[model samples]
Target: MRCQPPLKSMVYNWLNNNHACLLCDEPAEQPYPLCVACEAELPWLDDGCQTCALPLPMQGLTCAECRRRPPAFYRVEAPWHYGFPLDALISRFKYNSQWPLGNLLAQLLGRWLNHRYNEDLPRPTLLLPVPLSRRRLRQRGYNQAAMLARWLSGHTGIACNEQVLTRLLDTAAQQGLSARERQRNLHQAFSVTTSAPIEGRHVALIDDVLTTGATAQALASLLLKAGARRVDIYCLARTAKPGSA
Candidate 1:
């Protein structure tokens, strides 16, 4: 559903004959059709705040803001910061309609999981991706986070539950909003569905990135209200300002 339905090799070849990468308008390559040069330009953040993984000034545990008010979600993990080559990786997965990229990104997230929580990461019975608004779903044809969640569930042996956490209220993007503003914007944005309500169950949430943890926090609170015993987050990227935003 994310692409031009399914096409035979011949049909795909025909379509590719004249088409170019939308971002670079150059002759496209395989699958995503992004050229080699553009592929290498993904901006990967090295060091970042421990809480949100946002690029930081130096080594530190959690940002001051997060320390004062911890998020509802238990923990956040992301392989790369949402910048440069990493940002492009997300773009190719998002705008260029490269759905398979989710699989690779999810693999990276899984590795991060094993690396950090090797000793004691509680394996949840269900993996849930944060949901998108109906309007956004109609426009994008896919939920990138859902795709990644499916991938993580596949590799981790956890059942994927797409219906547990529902996005009832459509929200404005929180890219530049302050922490307080972000929380206010995302307040009550999510609720557990009537069917398959997670009462006294553990859940692992998947997403492409974690910024203010506002959305995740709100969702976690809803899950807690619905009786989820524990909620953890696994993300492809974590963006903490440490004050950077």
Candidate 2:
């Protein structure tokens, strides 16, 4: 014979197992904290550029920028377009320290990556989060990309290495900058850690969003120069070209 849990313990377990939908505040039905309806309403990235994941009018076409000059990374995989309630959720998680929201998004991304892997996407050997400068890390008390990578590693069973890249210079904020300006701002902003085991390995850089692709381009170029066989980007969302409907 076994003793049953105490009443309080039983109640706590029940509550812990039950989750409310993050978007609708109703009881969640999925494994994560989102309901079926809310999840269906997310701004899914159906068609995009093959190289940079920029939202395009149709499928299987590269954007003009990529055609003009390709990026360092081979490609970018993202689950959603940066819009609407998704943007609001990311903002809260990134700026307001709502970590649970970030974790939820990461879990969804991991599942999406797993599906892609089955559909012929090459699995990366290592995951590296875009690093933050020491000043920004101290100010935010956390790095959201690192958090996403950590959770993604758990979900995908891929190895995450946070120390592989170091932000060498604290650059200006990227908001409101033109693509050219953003690229210039990130110049020399990052470096590969000494003796990082990236050579001959397929590496993936994880981040919350890909806007101008400037940060991803810089990091990918650095990794390639450091002898990485290939580099790709994984982000939760991708922003459309400015003024695109």
Q: Give the number of the best model, judged by lDDT.
A: 2
Q: lDDT per residue, candidate 2, 1-245, as tens digits? A: 75745533543454467789988989897777899999999999999999999999999999999999999999999999999999999999899877778878998999999999999999999999999999999999889999899989998999999999999999999999999999999999999985458999999999999999999999999999999999999999999999997
TM-score of 1: 0.75
What TM-score does prediction 2 earn? 0.93
Worst 10 residues of 1 by lDDT: 7-16
lDDT of 1: 0.70
> Which residue runs does candidate 1 get wrong by more than 4 Å?
1-3, 6-51, 54-60, 195-197, 242-245
Prediction 2 global C-alpha lDDT: 0.92
The Cα RMSD in angstroms, rounded to one decimal, for candidate 2 relative to the true structure is: 6.0
